[model samples]
Target: MFRQLKKAATFAAAVLATTTLVSTAQAADYPEKAITLVVPYGAGGASDLAGRALAETARNYTNEQPVVVVNKTGNGGMNGARYVTEQKPDGYTLLLSRVGMALYPAVYTDSPVAWDDYTFLGILESTPMILAVNANSDIKTVDELLAKIKSSNGATTYAASGPTAIDGFTVQALLADADLDPLSASTLVPYKGGSALAAALLGGHVDFLAIAAGSLMPHIEAGKMRALMVYAPKRMDALPDVPTAKELGYNLAGQVDGWSALFAPKDLPEDVVAKWKDILSNVATNDQWLDLAKKRGSVSVVGDQDPAAFVKSQYELYNGMAKKFGYIQ
Candidate 1:
């Protein structure tokens, strides 16, 4: 009986060793083919731009392996996230996770994906949110906008991806901080993507919007739209004159901004994770990446924080906000 038990233990050990060796070998030859980086939103959005930029810059460190970006939009960015989480743990299939990744789970109790569903590679960049109206509009500042909303008796409308999306939360949080009901203070006109949201406001389909600055910076720069407030830790260098939400005393809105990160399905091999870390570190400082971020009104933050910890903290922060704002119980 003792001999039989010893033999079984030896076989198990050998199997474990073989499995580890195979995983190591696979990681060493990672990206033997093209990698698909799925963006969970439609094209022309901040997440899409970030994914494309990363795909282009990553090739420099990926032995020129193509990092293809695929848009799998729907469910307020949950569809693509769920798809990536369901993919094999191999590094080939990854996600261009956005702020929605953390916010969705907090806002929706039945969210299709959870915050920890994937192995976070690292944060790619942080994009500011701009609260703006068409240049043609008379509302010139956040105070004016809020005053108008209050005076309109809930007739004022704002565009966003959805009520649960990060962009939507920006406006909602601002309203909540102003002693107004987030849901009823200003009617939310839901739009599918950043482009649509911007168009909605520009075409006067919606009164105003607080959305990813990347999509609105062009219009704002051209004087087609007027930015009222920036939802970021500080004013963006490109928009130096704009006041941040925190400076304006809208603390909840100040905590809301757009950001993107790289992620793979859970349990990715250590070797694969290491390779991505090195690749992302290099891409962080790539001239093209930096230029794209600057032009898009974002800041590259590839290796500034530990991915796991950052995701966790963001989830907690948004979860608390959601509860406070009554988006979730």
Candidate 2:
């Protein structure tokens, strides 16, 4: 009986040692092959652009492995999230983690994964949503827009690609803050992606659109749209003249800061996580990456706080916001 117990203990120790050794070896050769950054949104959207930008500059601070951007659209970002979470936890496949990860689970009845299911790597950048109207429209300020909505009697239209997406809730929260019913004041039109929403706004299909400033910058610069209010803690340098929601007596902007992070599947090796945390920290400061971020109007969240803590805090913050906004029961 003693010999049998001793044999079992020794076998267990050997298995543990072997597993640790394999994980260490895998970490040493991490990214020996190309890495794929999966973006849940379709092409030309803000998330897609950020994913492509990160892929382009990943080698600047990490291994020379080619980082490819792949867009897997549908199911309110669940499809792409599932693809990465179900992939090997070797840090090869990554999700361009979006606010939806924290939000969908709170609001959507069919969320496939929760926040804790992801290996929180680090956040790279974040930006606040902006409310804008077509350049040709007479609405020029937040008050005017609110008045228009209050009087439109559901005649005014707004476009949000997905009902549960950041834009959708943002527009809802904005209207609600202004003492108007988001549902009764105007009709919320759904589009496929940012590109479609932009087209609709530009072609007079919608009265105004709420979206990330980065996605609307090119159009605004082209004189196709004009920003009215920014949902940020303060004014953005990119749109210095635009007032924040707080300035307009609406305090919802600070709650709407959307962020994007680099995340792997759960149980990723610690060494790999450290490697990516270091790489992303450096990438956030790299001149090329910073220049791209400025052009896109995204603020770098790297080095601002602990990555794991930031992810957890943001999840909680969005969860509370989801409840406050009545997205969840």
C-alpha RMSD of candidate 2: 2.4
lDDT of 1 at 263: 92
Top-scoring candidate (TM-score)? 1
- Per-candidate Cα RMSD to the true structure, in Å, reads 2.0, 2.4
Q: Report lDDT (Cα) of residue 197, candidate 1.
A: 91
- TM-score of candidate 2 relative to the true fold: 0.90
Quote the lDDT for 138 in model 2.
Answer: 94
* TM-scores of the models, in the order given: 0.93, 0.90
Model 1 off-target regions past 4 Å?
Answer: 1-18
Candidate 2 colliding pairs, count: 0
Please, what are the lDDT tens digits per residue for candidate 2 over residues 140-191? Answer: 8888988888887889999997656788877877777877765567788998
Reference-based lDDT, residue 304, model 2: 73
What are the runs in model 2 whose C-alpha is more than 4 Å off? 1-15, 308-329
